[model samples]
Target: MFKYAKRLQYPINIKKKDINMAKQLITQYGGIYYKKDIKK
Candidate 1:
């Protein structure tokens, strides 16, 4: 669904809890941080 949404925008205004969860996942996977609409 999200992958197909070409017009999506970001800085997304995500909740603090969601941001924390995302940080955890990124750390676990050794991934770099980026905005939702930006490709790594």
Candidate 2:
């Protein structure tokens, strides 16, 4: 187990039809949030 932020529903559920696209989008979103959090 590990710690997590309060809102844990950012990376929305995705279908298997476009896994690659979903992954890229999630990565971008996650990277932005990650950097933002580090500054806090």
Candidate 3:
């Protein structure tokens, strides 16, 4: 699961259409959250 954080350390800017779609696919597969791998 992914939790909405206040902000991400870096931005996720996908400009290219193809690349953007790929990013979406990856997000759907593994998700796009920090995975609580912060401040740990």
Candidate 4:
């Protein structure tokens, strides 16, 4: 469990890979993070 984080976690090695896939993963993870942030 996490209390708080200073940075947003993005996919590993995404910088050298496909931008599209990176975006998809970011959005998916970001949504969950966003919801949790609001709940807090």
Candidate 5:
């Protein structure tokens, strides 16, 4: 089953990895926001 995270899950090792790629991945996981003022 799927679960929600209340805090930091684990320590990620990004040594010698591309910073930009990491940022993009994190942003993508942030999901989408729905606003009442926004139109579909």
Candidate 6:
């Protein structure tokens, strides 16, 4: 049970980092993270 919980938390932590990076990239590129009509 402990191992499973650790595995689940690992992905969530990675996703949070990814989101932070995306936000930084968007800001760096003038607040445009993607082109129009793209899914979020």
Q: At residue 27, what lDDT does model 5 achieve?
A: 60
- Compared with the true structure, model 4 gives a TM-score of 0.36
* Model 1 spans > 4 angstroms off: 1-17, 31-40
Tell me how many clashing residue pairs each candidate has.
0, 0, 0, 0, 0, 0
| Candidate 1 structure quality by residue, lDDT tens digits, 1-40 | 3566566565566555666676677666665544453354
- Model 1 pairs whose backbones collide: none
Q: What is the lDDT of residue 37 in candidate 6?
A: 28
lDDT of each: 0.59, 0.61, 0.64, 0.60, 0.58, 0.55
Worst ten-residue run, lDDT, model 3? 31-40
Candidate 5 segments exceeding 4 Å error: 1-15, 31-40
* Candidate 4, 1-40: lDDT as tens digits: 8797577576544347675675567668786564444332
Q: Evaluate model 1: give its lDDT.
A: 0.59
lDDT of 4: 0.60
User: How many backbone clashes can be found in candidate 4?
Assistant: 0
Q: lDDT value for candidate 2?
A: 0.61
Candidate 2's TM-score: 0.35
TM-scores of the models, in the order given: 0.34, 0.35, 0.36, 0.36, 0.35, 0.33
RMSD of 5: 9.0
lDDT of 3 by residue, 1-40 (tens): 9997798888899665785565566667767663443242
Candidate 2 residues 1-40, lDDT tens each? 9997787656666455775675567668786454444332
TM-score sort, best first: 4, 3, 2, 5, 1, 6
